[model samples]
Target: MAEEEKRASPEPPLPSPPESSSQPEHPPPETSTPPATFDPSRMIGIIKRKALIKDLAAAYHVECLALCRELLELQKRKDEPFLDTKATEDLRKETLRSSSKRAKKKR
Candidate 1:
């Protein structure tokens, strides 16, 4: 009966030790050199392509900024009314003269 009671109430499992914070849980990846198949010319080509793309993107950005400034200036001009009566009179006179010439031509 005593042996049966001891078997029934077994000792609790031992607690595991806490992990050390000083060491990382996973090992660092190993650094490796480029493969023997690597070609220096191919690497240079890729670098040149990247530089060309960067330059093109910069130029495109500058062009867009310039266009935006021009559009804004145009909008400002459009908002203002042209107050040149002399220019308007000249245009009107030219139109009349052209119409008279056209009428003469029709004759």
Candidate 2:
């Protein structure tokens, strides 16, 4: 009776394979990619932002140097004219970095 019942019950069917897509399996080559784009207005905004940061940094540096100079003067002898450090004049000659130089340093 058990053997007859097992033979009467049919097995479930197997699942079919997935269908293929229209696009290629692998991505297209870089050389075949679309041409690069340029936006003048967006670029100008970046340039303006960089300049603003530079100005702010310069102002901050000058303020810090002024505080250090005052501290030095108070600690030093009255006979000493001023701080002899070369960086003392850095306030007058602030470093101006170009975009090219900055990009190279990043790499």
Candidate 3:
């Protein structure tokens, strides 16, 4: 009966896989060259294109600032009265002088 019970039991499960290490097994050498597919001229062209875009953006910013200043000045002028106090004073003096001259002529 013991021999028959042993034969009927299933085999034990396989052992669990080995625990993985946090670090890589082998690191690449530091002195390795870039891949042959990489082209230096292509990188240079990309850098020049970026510089051109930056320069154009800066020029656009300057032009926008200048236009904003011009618009602000125009708005300020529009807010001002048609005739300033100084000009009104001069006009009043001219009118008084003309009226005095007319009175003198009538007398």
Model 1, 7-98: lDDT tens per residue? 99968999999889999989997679655697899999999999999999999999999999999999878765554665788899999998
Clashing residue pairs for model 3 = none
TM-score per model over all chains: 0.39, 0.38, 0.42
Cα error, candidate 3, residue 18 (Å): 32
lDDT of 2 by residue, 1-107 (tens): 99999999988888887767976889767886578689799899999999999999999999999999998877776535455444555544545334324545554
> After superposition, which runs of candidate 1 have C-alpha atoms over 4 Å from their true positions?
1-37, 82-107
Weakest 10 consecutive residues of candidate 3 by summed lDDT: 98-107
Number of the top-ranking candidate, with TM-score as the measure:
3
Assess the local accuracy of residue 50 in candidate 1 as a C-alpha lDDT between 0 and 100. 100
Error of 2 at 72 (Å): 0.6
All candidates in order of TM-score, best leading: 3, 1, 2
Clashing pairs in 2: none
The true-versus-predicted C-alpha distance at residue 34 of model 2, in Å, is 8.1
Descending-lDDT candidate ranking: 3, 1, 2
lDDT per residue (tens digit) for residues 2-106 in model 3: 999999999999999886897678976777776679789999999999999999999999999999999999987976665476688899999999888755555
- The CA lDDT at 17 in model 1 is 90
